[model samples]
Each structure stands twice: as structure tokens, then as C-alpha cells.
Target: MTIRFAAVSACALLTLAACNRTQEPVAPASAAATPPVESPAIPAADPNALTAEGLGPVRIGMTRADLVKLWGEDSQPNAVGGPDPETCDEFHPAKAPADVMVMIQNGVLTRITLTRGATIKTDRGFGVGDSAMAIKQAYGGAIVAQPHKYQDAPAEDLFAWPHGGATTYVTDPAARGVRYEIGGDGKVMKVHAGDPSIQQVEGCL
Candidate 1:
């Protein structure tokens, strides 16, 4: 025939160019589409940022942004009177002494009141059930106590005899002043001296 039909059309055009060079090279669907990578953003907390070693390690589920990252706002919400819970809100600290409250509620935190003389239980001078090493062996260092800041009670300090008379007749230790209320599980619910409702003693050690 015409040279076997032109050599069977040049071997069927070299088998369609070797089957399009073994196919499979078509990417470019936007180069196999790929675009997504971005994440970083989390910052917003400063309600009043507190401290006193951050209110001595507060506890109770903590939140209101962790009490504004440990107290910073200067705390102020107190509703009307006090005693907490109307949803709660009371945090005064102008230098301290609004009876030292800090209740919070929906935002978390429950209570904290280091008022009434600011804590000093007893350095041996006896009062809230006596026996601070037996009142430091019956008044050795000449006793003179300190610590005072009362509002609703609890958190006291005040010893006497810096030449004020009366060594320990049993009561009237100068008009008395030794409180130390620290509840919320931390312990020390109440010690007494004068007006924690007239001697509201409690455990100690």
C-alpha cells in the first residue's frame, strides 16, 4: 500500500507522544490551593489589680479575671450597708480601713476582712484567752502591744503597760484590743480583746 499506509501513520504518531508523557501534571488550581495560618490575641484584665502579696493568696474559685490579676482597681462596689451578699460588692482600700471588706460575687471571690486593729493575735501579754507562752512568762519584755484597725471587728493588735499602769489584773488590759478574724477556711475565725461583741474568743496556736 503506500508504504503500508505511511507506516501506519508513523506508528500512530508515536503512540500519541507516549501517552502525553505519562500524564499526571496539572496542579495550578491556584497551585493546589493553600492559605491559612494566623492566631494570637488575648489580653484584657485590670479591674483594680490588688496586692498585699495579692491579698495574701486569695482563694474560692477566683475569677473576676482572677480578681483583676490580684487586685488593682482599688476595690469599690459596696452596695448599701455591709455584711456582704446582695450578690456582694465591697472592697475599700484608700490606705485601708472601711472595716477592711472585699466580698465580690458573680465575678467570684467571697469574703475577706482583715480589719479591727490589723491582726496581731498576741505576742504574749494575754487577753483573748491568754497564754502566749503564758503571756511571755508573765510580762518579761515589759509588754506594749500594737496593731489596730477596727470597723466590723476582727484583725486587731494592741498591748499595753508602756508605763500605763495595771499589769494583768485579769481584764481591763488598758481597755483591751486584740482581735484576729480570718475565716474563709484559712482558720482563726475570731480572737478577742474588747468589742468583738465583748470577748468573742476562738481557737489559736
Candidate 2:
């Protein structure tokens, strides 16, 4: 009877242990792991942004040799009409963006011209197709209005003197500015930036 009682007690304890083991919580398989949140991507800088100093990697007062080195030897130099190369010439580098031209005056880069259909924009946020009113509004009192050399009425020129220096009288070679040529539609036809060459009506003409 003692042996049977001991056996019975051991059996009861074992059954209790089995029952407890079956009831143990498994932590619910750790609820499917959540994915981490991602941040928004940042925009890339514009390579064709026009500015008072220059456009993109090309700056005002850069030398032709510097441009040749920058654009590589394969980048051929294009002359602007009949202008003497010694006085002024335009270079359309093969590596440069389309519709963008650089004027090299006295072997130094003096102006950057953004022609029609160019996606380039001024530092002030003005572009080829922007309206004259938009440019005026963007520049406020910093810009001076002038008659277009070849156009009449709504068409005109907008000159910006960022440092309170006039392009006509300012002799400082470093004096930088921008010029917007407005078409008869009152929309910007072209954009010019850099030194006094920004005022060149005919562009190396």
C-alpha cells in the first residue's frame, strides 16, 4: 500500500506538470514584425541654373583655356558670326547643355546666353518663357526697364544691377548682372548673364 500510494502521488504530480506545460503562453509568435518608415528623397541640384556670376559650372571671367580644359579637348570652339576671335567669340562646348552659349571676350568668358527653348533659369528664378511682369515682380526695384533694340511696344529689355552698379557706367570687370529679353508677346525670349556683355543686344555682333 505504501508503494502504491507513492506511485499514485508521482503519477498525479507528473499529470499536473504536463497540464501546466500545455497551458504555457507562447507569446503569440511575436506579431509579424513591422516595416521601418522611409524618408522622402531629396531633389537634385539643377545643373543649368543661371546666376549673376555664371551658369552651372561656368563662371564669369573664366578663360577660354579654362573652358577648353573643363569641356575637354573634344569640345570644339564655335565662332559667333564675323566677330574677331581676339575681341569676342561664342563657344558652344560639346559637353555644354543644348541651347546654351558662352561668350569669350578677349580670351575670357564674359557672358552666358540661354537661347529660346532652353530650360536654364536665372538665380532670381526667371526663365526663357517667363513673363515680363513675372520678372518685374521677381526682381522688384532691382531691375531697370529699357526699350528693346529690335522690338517695339510690349517687347523690351529688363536689366538687373544686383550691386547698384549700372552696366553702361560700371567699369568694374567683376560687376555682374543679368539681362532678360522680352518678346512682343511680353514673354522672355532669352536670358543673358555675367559681365557687361549681358547688355549686348546682338550677342558678339
Candidate 2, residues 1-205: lDDT per residue as tens digits?
Answer: 9999999999999999988885656676668788998889977656668888887777888888897776543245443443687787776777777788888888888888889888878877788999999989878888888899888969999999774457354567777888899999999999988887787787778
lDDT of 1: 0.40
**Candidate that would win on TM-score:** 2
TM-score to native of every candidate shown: 0.22, 0.72
RMSD in angstroms between candidate 2 and the native structure over all alpha carbons:
7.0
Worst 10 residues of 2 by lDDT: 73-82
Candidate 1 lDDT over 18-91, as tens digits, reads 98886778876555556787676755433222221123444433665566565544445443423443454545
Model 1 spans with C-alpha error above 4 angstroms: 9-13, 16-20, 31-40, 44-56, 59-205
